[model samples]
Target: MSEGNGPTEGQDKVQSSAPPNAVWPLRDKEGNVTVPFAYGTIAFWQGKRAQEYQTHKWHVYVRGANNEDLTPLIERVIFQLHPSFNNPTRVIDTAPFHVCELGWGEFEITIRIFFHDGPEQGLEIKHMLKLFPRVGEPSQKKPVVSERHDEFVFNAPNEGLLQRIGMCNTRMPNGGPAWATIEPFFSPLNEHEELLRIQAAQRRVQAEITLVKEELENEEQILSFLQDEVKKLEPSIVKKPPGT
Candidate 1:
């Protein structure tokens, strides 16, 4: 990731076919790039878990153009949650940039995103928290209403990070794309999907074990019948041994 302060507005604009302005593009697997934009969402709502005291809920999610969740690329996300909660300003440095926090009331949340690889290309965004919907408002399905799409620019990004950001950057250090470092942070790593996968795997294993047990029982029954028949044939042979 690039290491520096946020880029100015003028640094991000491109007026001609060739990028002439100051903005330098990070390399993806494709090639040397000029300006790259990623999708970002900032949203907030009332508590889903239902706390005795009213608390607001919020999250910031980043993703690639293909709609792949990129929340994991974030190295540290500083959230200005609210004034009421203990340590209202929280800094989360981990995978899953979509932060979950509680506050006593509703307010605007200012978020600062720091990328694990591109520290210099840090981004600042805002989201307004809504506790209650308007009266007679049509029921909406999405949880968070305040969402946005933002284009972020990186100037002179390090070779390592270039491979990770663009549509393509193949010459990464580990023989993988540069984005490999941040790949683990994708929001798909969230607990819900992971739990489902584990449950499904466990079910498959149980079914296999049960089937094997039933097959073993059938084999045992067959073996027992064969043994009894052999004993009866031995008795018959003994009775006829004198003349036959």
Candidate 2:
């Protein structure tokens, strides 16, 4: 898949009645719950003299967009680290969900997110850890930041989940959830802001496609003109046959 075109975000739907053993709240009119989130790593390079294996310190985290607390919607997060590490599997069950360590090598980290309600299956995701700067980019003291934005869609959600989602989206001073009172690293996503970002990316890709098409058309025109000129000269360029 192209960049920003990875797997679809998590979508949980309830199709049939719950099992006899399980009890869930009545379905709400909202019908769908969307929780926007971002996951990736932030890494800082140690000085050149540091050990090769410990040249970079990094933290891998899954956070609600703009650093909003995810405790309301997420029950816990399971992170599978590289096998080289001792006890490679780690579980976090609170806000500021993250793991911190020192390492130089890069690898793909597996993350599984469990929701607070039913749908026993957890959403699985993979992220590639990057520590070094790309070619042609200047190196600096600032940490390298790489993250992807996505949202979870819960369809036909029960009343309990709808209430939790409501708490997450509501603003403070209006009986919002406790987490809303906390400060975020960045401004919260405004209405339609996610749509606007997607549209902007699409526009950039479309512009590049248009330029390529124009170049192809120009080359085709040049080829056609050369073929016509060659046809015009053929008669004179061809010597008459001896019999003719």
Candidate 3:
């Protein structure tokens, strides 16, 4: 009976204690899940965290041939965030600005402009990708295709926060391509306003100069007429003006 009780006691002890061979099946043997890569998604990871994680978002663009209105494509742009990356990825809202539904042949892609909020908050981008239709389907298999990654880098020396809001510079990561020139996001109205101000100032100065010259000419004419009248009156009064 003691021998029989010993096996029962060992079984009870094992049941009371935690199972030694218990494992979480969701994770791999190394505690990492395999993730496949694909196009139309920007892959990025946070550097500081110990837990390995990845993020992905769909890419959208507006195209044109030559310089024309390609905004139609932009209006129809779509946003699709991966389930794993949605929490960390930024989403764009497009309620503020008016979107025109006209397209040109030239190509221009719009992206969420990211800015550092503070030490605690990670970078935030105004998610504006919901306006268009989804373009390419996401791939599921391995050996992922390399999508055309259009990344912009800035080397600003004295740009303020306001100035940096819309400034963009296209550059390649990992020294693949040379840095391009900085570009601004000003509309046509801003440029037109500046030109109109300069032209109006020039016109005002020209009008002032013309008015002064006309006044001087009128004064000289009046003086000449008065001198002639005086000469004619002297001849009539003295009766010897013709001989003089």
TM-scores for the candidates: 0.42, 0.60, 0.21
**What is candidate 3's lDDT per residue for 1-244, written digit by digit as tens?**
0011101001111111111211111123553321111112111112223222211212232111111221211122233332332232224332111121111111223333323321222212232322122454333221111132121222231234223322211111111011000001111123355457768989999999999999999999999999999998986784556757
Regions of candidate 2 where Cα sits further than 4 Å from its true position? 1-31, 136-140, 169-193, 196-244
Model 2, position 152, has a per-residue lDDT of 80
lDDT of 3 at 139: 33
Q: If the candidates were sorted by their lDDT against the true structure, best first, what order would they fall in?
A: 2, 1, 3
Best by TM-score: 2
Give the per-residue Cα lDDT of candidate 2 at 118.
38
Q: Write the per-residue lDDT of candidate 1 for residues 33-113, one digit (tens) a residue.
A: 433223333223333554545333333343332233334345677877556655657685643344444433456778887
* Candidate 2 per-residue lDDT over residues 1-244, each given as its tens digit: 0011111122232221111211122233575556677788776677778766777766677876645446777889998888776566879786656776677688899999998873679799999988877754424456676777777878877777776765554222221222221122223445387789878999999999999999999999999999999999988896878999
Give me the candidate number with maximum lDDT: 2
How do the candidates rank by TM-score, highest first?
2, 1, 3
- For candidate 1, report its TM-score: 0.42
Q: Ten consecutive residues with minimal summed lDDT in candidate 3?
A: 1-10
User: In candidate 2, which residue pairs get closer than 3 Å at backbone N, Cα or C atoms, i.e. clash?
Assistant: none
Q: Which stretches of candidate 1 lie over 4 Å from their true place?
A: 1-52, 55-73, 117-121, 134-144, 166-244
Q: Which 10-residue span in candidate 2 carries the lowest summed lDDT?
A: 1-10
What's model 3's TM-score?
Answer: 0.21
